[model samples]
Target: MLAVLAGCTGGSRDIGEGKPGSSGDAIQIFPRDGAEDVGPERRIEVSIPDGRLERVRVTRVEDARRQAVPGRISDDGLSWRPAGGAGRLALASKYSVEAVAVDAEGRRSARNTAFTTVVPDHRFIGYFKPENRSTVGTGMIVAFEFSRPIRDRAAVQKAIRVTADPAVEVVGHWFGRDRLDFRPAAYWKPGTEVTVEVGLRDVEGAPGVFGSQRRTVGFTVGRSQVSLVDAAGHTMQVRRDGELISTVPISAGAPKTPTYNGKMVVSEMHEVTRMDGRTVGFGGEYDIKDVPHAIRLTESGTFLHGNYWAPADTFGSLNTSHGCIGLRDVKGGGGSAPGGWFFDRTLIGDVVEVVNSPDRKVAPDNGLSGWNLSWQAWKAGSALR
Candidate 1:
């Protein structure tokens, strides 16, 4: 009996240990162990030969946030990867991975690895408007302004997308290095639902600069209203669906400081605001304490507002004041004056075309005025096309 027991013990194999002559079966991981400066957009993966993956786990080390990683085994059962549920990794973060595999001979092998991603040196953000979820007019352009200049404009523009529910071809036009606007060739259809997506996360905007924005914004188009202002005529003709609604007499910019001649959008309206010329590069030419019914036209300090201080007789027949389209209004803006009525009728995205001005056309970058460019020119400005 002792002789038999000694022989059996010598031949017995330990469970969970690799079978004899199968030492070559092993698992390999990428972003190999102790890896650093890894891109967050990269996927985690494992490879096995002569074996099948049994389980895998990935966790963020900082807060112990277990990543929702869905893994898949290759058809041949020799490889596996975090397939679907796994989102892009966090920036400048450490992650841990654990995996187990079983060989064809039923021998099990396990592995554990950790890796770190690159710490972005510079960060970028995109500021967009008309405020998310707000309803705007058909001429509204979805605009974005970057906090810093973007060097990789083509790649950045590709990351941004816009879609309309009714399905219009939306295109993006870069105003400059830092500004971008998206719109259809013509005005949007009424009641159209528009969605803008900014998928810039982890994208290299420049050397050592990374974009950190992943957002989706939706807005609706309210109605169709277009107002035409003939600077030479000194009158504003309000129209809706090609029919005249109201005609209001107005005073435009003085000859020295002519109003920008082009199509502008009603960006915002304020019941009361202080106008300081110094704020717009003028050396204290005028500083009205309370300018009423102010509507922003251009970013270069041009406004269509109530001028309570100007002579009422000058509103319809003359060009007065500095680069502003002024309407006769009371000081308090309490009554239903011409300026208040216009302000009430106007909405964000309403188109205002200023024609026959002595001044030059507004720059496309000035306060969402991209409509000043021709359709061919606008499309030419897009990097995607």
Candidate 2:
């Protein structure tokens, strides 16, 4: 009885050729032993020319998890193949096949073979915002920045699901090829819970590129807070749940370098950070090593930060700095300064709207400023339509 099998490989291979005078049956296996980089669409089967297949078993191991590949033998026992839906192999996985065959003379032969599926050369991952288990403001938008440019936007979009606990309708919008943002028609209600399910694993996002993420992230919406910055009036009205809380005096950008006007979300905050003019395309005009209470409003270096170098009276009376909203605060933060006071009450997803500025509205894709776009316009960006 023959116990070992070996075969030549191209896309598929035939294994275990019996000797001319041998009584044992020759067992054949597709995807011959030692096959590498096999595609998921290839067929997997075992067969013999003139004998009955007694048993056939296939197992697949992927990401350290092993599972059996369901299959069945032909009625005549001459062949065996994976069952429907199991015919497609898994990518980046190792498969092992074992088979036993009985010849007409009652001789038995066994064969074993193994192969490896393709490891995608190009893989994409999404870096999402708001984090898992975080509590954010109502204005928070679930955004994903994909590592690779996705050619099949519909496929990528379908792989992700964003749902709210209160059962609001949330839709996804594609910001070009690398970013996807999800939001409801209006701001999320306070105390709402949102869940993001990313099921992109092995999904073809582009030609020859696959996605490698399978995760579930969730966040809770805290109280609603939206601060309106009036550049012309040099004041910010802080509102909490439709009621006016406090009015903060602010110094917006100068006339020459005006702040962008739009609905912007607070994407980041820092107690104290350095601000350099050169970093934002401006010449070496000013560089503050310690700008306190910095709240990032846009990706283009627009910040609502503490202003110590400017005269204390510069706030509320004059638009002094370049393109950042300045609040009254001393160097290194702390104290009862308006900058620190507001920063303390802020959440990552809080909304900050700047009105009456000379500059154009902040782009919708800049930071998390999707609220700047109308609901119709936002929905128009969806690939699914």
Whole-model lDDT values for every prediction: 0.71, 0.76
User: What's the CA RMSD of model 2 in angstroms?
Assistant: 24.1
Clashing pairs in 1: none
Mark the regions of model 2 whose C-alpha exceeds 4 Å error after superposition. Answer: 1-120
lDDT of 2 by residue, 345-369 (tens): 9999999999998988988998899
lDDT of 1 at 249: 92
Compared with the true structure, the alpha-carbon lDDT of candidate 1 equals 0.71
**Clashes per model (N, Cα, C within 3 A):** 0, 0
Top candidate on TM-score is: 2
